[model samples]
Target: MMRPIYLLLGLILSLAGLRAQNLTAPLLSGSWQSTYHNPAMVHFLPQPVTLGLPGLANDLRLENLQYKDIFVEEGGRRILDFTAWSDLVDEQNTVQDVYSFETFGLAVQRGRLGLSLYHRLRVEGEAQYSRTLVDLIALGNAPFIGQTVELAPQGEVVSFHEVGLGLSYALTDKIAVGGRVKYLVGTSGVQLAEGGSIQLRTAEESFALTLEQDVRVNTVNALEYERLDSFTLDYDPTRLSFSELTGANTGLAFDFGIAVNLDRLRLNASVVDLGASIDWTEDVSSFRFTGTETFDGLDLLEDLLRDTISLATAVDSLLLTYEPERSTAGFQSQIGASVYLGGEYDITERLTAGAMLVLEDRLGELQPAVALLGRYAVADWLQVGINLNHRTGIRTNLGLHLYASPGRVRVFASSDKFFTLLSTGNTALAGVRLGLSLALGQRAAERPGRSRSSFASLP
Candidate 1:
């Protein structure tokens, strides 16, 4: 039990090293990747043909906690300490980790019409809890004696592969609209519903406790089910093979966006990952506990504080008092959704400024963020920009973006929190976004003496 907990914590810490969506990608006007943020931007691609190979584009975000919360300096050394870390946790907290990678991408444009297709893999996980739960594990329930430690914990993990088709067209010279349809193949998932809690109260010279738990774990592969079964029988999970790839779940989703061009100003808006849900129907299992039991005259508190007994031993003894029922059932999980709105102004022939607003839903809560941007076009082959952003519960962060269309190949990269790269200490946020692609056909905005009017037409 301690090993699994440690492994989970290690995984979370490692994932925290990478962070959120490409909030600055849309500002790279000529790059094909811009379409990912606002599909309508496809109409603004400088090249007529674009092909992105596997591992070219990636985005990740951490919704809760930060580097400092997971990695801390103790006694002149930095280490992963959950017990020390629990002191920084809020009374109510939610942790969300999302990762998306483009496996294959392509885009083609002719005059006012544009088309795109891409394959991607996305994994998202979220956990919500009350601080009391953390204290139960980090400091033990000795401090909350005689009080009900209300525990309402919920979490879910889902991974799926997606194939998306997008289409965009210019309506006159000022407006363009686009939409994408995505087909998803779910590979794995686990969800915890609301039905568990623990209450510990200390009596005169002993401790009394009540426990209740109800949870469900789901997966696409039958081997995962066998692994859980093996754990219940022999407490050995290493025998489980987790490399199998099988499609046992499926779903559909869509994205809609529009961009408007007006003289020296451009406005854009889009809603992505809307109406996405996964249904787990294969290799499903559910466990539920609904009875109450009390322990009397047990020196559980002293043993817990003194390390005289292991937490697993204490839990196993309690479980023998009342066991939970295990069964099989199907369940559904929803994907995180987001909305983006942006505007940009051409201050000069070689300079532009912009602002964007983003609203993302995580764990049934809406998280809002804003960014201010400045870009300089050094040449037809090079462009650079900086973004200053602020998101709820996070400190202001700076980001950098570079788009280089050197010869027939294009390369681009952006990070929402670039300053973290130079920090020797821990950061509150971190992220990286980059991609490489081959481009061909006439350069749409590269004609000699073409006025800035054409270059500023869309953003």
Candidate 2:
């Protein structure tokens, strides 16, 4: 049937020309739970009782956001729309490995003063396709009519489903701070066009083949789709099946924190999540553009003037080229930090062993990693733990935590970049983080039969 309508109009004009050469580039900031730690999980919180205002405290932490094999050895692609045609093809760039979201949080204390509530959820799937074979010249230097072919583009499929919320405060007990406000609801995708079909072979005698089509299709009614997860626009499977592009000017993000504790030997430092940015104006009530022209022996060619004034000048030249209405009011920014050290010397008298050393910093040029936590207690409810995190190209996370009896049900497991390794340049993400925590009403009356000598003689 006309070669599947010219291969579906050359795969929708090479997915609108690789989304206009990947909207230019430069936009991959940071901040997404800092990959792990300081997520307020506070070592799986549940040990604070001085309500009578002695050390002042109120905290809550729940963990479960496992990440597969994060950065799978720089293997496992994720987003490379086009490194500007990477020198014609040596091949590299196109991966959006999806799998994110499964978070919940809440923290409140009143001694050193503290308050927190954070939530992040995501659902993304990506796909990439490429094909190139272009070489066309002479548009003003007559060389030999009928011999020019071009179709420089490959393939793509982007999907991002989202949900986020944040709030944090901590002025003491080691310094604390926070901020968050995000909503990306959902988004769908499909993009394939860089150089898929362009054939031109000439031996003269009566040859004829000329092609230099630069198709155009633009749409960027931003609601925040490139910073802190922002994507919406569904239904378009040849007539509709990816419609859900939500917008009404919803985009604003922020976060900051700093924690520290050094009791003469044991240590702890913090600069938890810190991200704030927004710039995505909305106004793209459905765009349109389609082109097709085939000729081999003449069956009827020649019909110019594509549609909708070249799709509104390709969405106003891709919003003036990558959110350029003067830097879209605010480009992108994110920061992260964490450092910890633990101590405890005792092998008898009920047994005890502890160890901790962690260092981290994301967004600021990327590159920083170190994690190791260990603990063991034989009796009195039993306790055992171990956690190791490493990043030298991402990937390397091991975990195991078990605290039975009176510990209000604690069990954990990990291995697979723990939380999809973050920083040092994200490469999609791996997955796994199952969790459950419940200790209602004043933390179940301070568990452990609540009797530290009858509340230590009623305070």
Candidate 3:
């Protein structure tokens, strides 16, 4: 029975799960892709009619954990080492990944009104964990004899497709406002519900193990259990039906944005996924767990990770002591939201410098970050930019963004991990956005020495 506690703590952690702010997406200016940053951005687009062929973007963030910080070379082989990185972990660490695609989209501009209709598919998931848990697992409980280490691993994943209608209007050529209404079709998912978590602590006397469990999980064909020892959390568990994956759930969300221009200075503000929530109603189940037990032998947890005890033995032993309660019920969950506030100053006909303040809601906590960036148009067909973003006690990130428009076809890409491409990086944050579209309109003739990339005010 005591060994089961070790099995729960030692191994369930190595596996992976924040939303990262988009600092460079909007700088491309005058493209269908840029409008996603802030719907009001449509007012500054150079083309009259923009048709989105198809495009997708991925934003990823892993805080307080980095590959370079955890791995080292030993005997010509890469070894798993956490000696230099564990202490730097935050009280509540996060891993967020967001992927979105604009399947079919269209934007039309007329006099003072801009209208758009599009279908976007988005899949977002995040995991939030406590640093105390990592410390206890890596350094063991000897560091604090009288203190109690309390922590739990938490995460959620959700997928959905949405059809959105957006509208933008210019009060004056210098000021524009926009909003979007989205109807979401919820898909299959698994999420740790609110008021659900487990705490583990080690007592000084006998070095006893005290694990307090309080876990409630909501599922939509993502989790199933015949018994504690017989369960599956895989993507397709054979129990999932098509109705649960296609239209078993539903949600609603709204987005609003405003863009203002004053001479060479431009200001933009927007909120995404505001008041977004989904209700899982079909093929749903809830698992409720609440209990506490004190057993001697906190020191045996490390050995549990080794082959000393078979997993079957540990799980069966755990079932003898702990039994989770299960029921058929529906639960509602929210899709987190983010707000962006930024301003840019034109340094030259082809250069713009800006700063952005990003605020994101993780579960229920508010996290703030800042970005400083600049964009330049090398020529009418190419634009490039650089960005530097920072967070306290986490890490500093540097990135690049680019946009190219050859004739009526437009393409763009952005990343916060120029130092770490794809999934490789020494920093705590890595993100990339790539997409392509076609601008269908008469190309604006270039003015003498002025650049077409210049977000010229609406005429």
Best by TM-score: 3
Model 3: residues with Cα > 4 Å off, grouped in runs: 1-21, 71-85, 141-148, 201-203, 236-246, 306-321, 422-429, 446-459
Clashes of 2: 34
Q: Relative to the true structure, how large is the alpha-carbon lDDT of every model?
A: 0.62, 0.29, 0.66
Candidate 3, residues 132-200, lDDT tens digits: the string is 655654565666455665665667777777777899998887788999988877776667765555666
Strongest candidate by lDDT: 3
Listed in order, each prediction's TM-score against the native is: 0.81, 0.27, 0.83
Off by over 4 Å in 2: 1-116, 119-207, 210-218, 222-282, 294-459
Q: Model 2, 187-245: lDDT tens per residue?
A: 32333223344333332444343332332222333222342122233323212112342
Residue 399's lDDT within candidate 3 is: 87
Least accurate 10 contiguous residues by lDDT in model 3? 11-20
Worst 10 residues of 2 by lDDT: 20-29
TM-score of candidate 3 to 2 decimals: 0.83
Ordered by TM-score, highest first, the candidates read 3, 1, 2
**Residue 264 alpha-carbon offset, candidate 2, angstroms:** 22
